[model samples]
Target: MGTVEDYLGGLRPEQAHALRRVVELARGLAPDAEEGTSYGMPALLVGGRPLIGVTAAARHLSLFPFSPAVVAAVAPDLEGFSLSKGTIRFTPEAPLPDAVVEQVVRLRRAELGA
Candidate 1:
């Protein structure tokens, strides 16, 4: 999507709210992150990298970690959550864990020195 609003438009209210929470957490972790689009989804750029992006999928919201290390580290907690290489998927009814959200952002910031 071209903008956060554009991407969020397709999401249900709950999904949008959860994605917004993740975005907010990431922004708090890295205040200098620049808002932008990546892979046709709303993304946050930190230290010249797309640190995180969220897509509104047909059945759930998908979050791209943009860092394999972070994904691997949190793989255990993500067992119940649908996931791919760097993506964590959750439905509108199953919002992501806040602790996991914070961990991802904080770890990424430390890794990127942001």
Candidate 2:
């Protein structure tokens, strides 16, 4: 994708809306991050490194901090949400909490040394 907007545009309204909120929140935390992609997924790039990525899957929305450690550190707060080694999965109807997202973004930034 040329930019995150292109990725978000292809999503369902609620999914796109949720991902937008994610990108907005991440932007507030890392002003240096730019709209970009990592491994073909829409992402926020910090120092040219993918800090965080938000996208829609077939059945749920996903957030990738691109670090398994970040996902592990935040797993306790996620509770009912699905978690992989480096991803958090949720639905737009039950979007991730802003506070949790804030932590994820900060941790990813720290991990990236951004």
Candidate 3:
């Protein structure tokens, strides 16, 4: 039953700071996206569909771009970062770049027809 703010508040200072930036970037890209929880993670929903989700892990912060196609599109640019089928992992020390974040959001928005 926790909110996004509550989730962010529970993270360590560094983790929280990095996640806050991601959240800010998401909101900037999709102003109308609703803030809520998805699969126990803080997520943004556009047109009632999950747009993006972020998580604070022990070693790094995770960005769930919510699209495999988006991940594949950004894969070349993610050479130095750790990535999975759906999650892009980065450290608090070296947070995700703004451009990368924007690209992810833009792709997801397009996929959602937003």
Candidate 3: residue 45 Cα off by (Å): 0.6
Candidate 2 C-alpha lDDT tens digits along 1-114: 768989999888989998899889999999998988998898999989999988798899999999999999999999999999999999989999999999999999988877
The estimated TM-scores of all candidates read: 0.88, 0.96, 0.95
Q: Rank by lDDT, highest first.
A: 2, 3, 1
lDDT of 3: 0.90
Q: Write the per-residue lDDT of candidate 1 for residues 12-113, one digit (tens) a residue.
A: 788888788888888887789988887766898876688888887778888887887888888898778987778888876788888898898888778777
RMSD after CA superposition, every candidate:
1.6, 0.8, 1.0
Could you tell me the lDDT of residue 79 within candidate 1? 74
Span of ten consecutive residues with least summed lDDT in model 3: 1-10
Instruction: Kindly list the per-residue Cα lDDT of model 3 for residues 28-83, writing each as its tens digit.
Output: 99999988878777899998899999998888899998888999899898888999
As a TM-score, model 2 comes out at 0.96
- Which candidate has the highest TM-score of all? 2
- Those runs of model 2 whose alpha carbons end farther than 4 Å from true positions after fitting are none
lDDT top scorer: 2
Which candidate model has the greater TM-score, 1 or 2?
A: 2
Q: What is the lDDT of residue 24 in candidate 1?
A: 83
Count backbone overlaps in model 2: 0
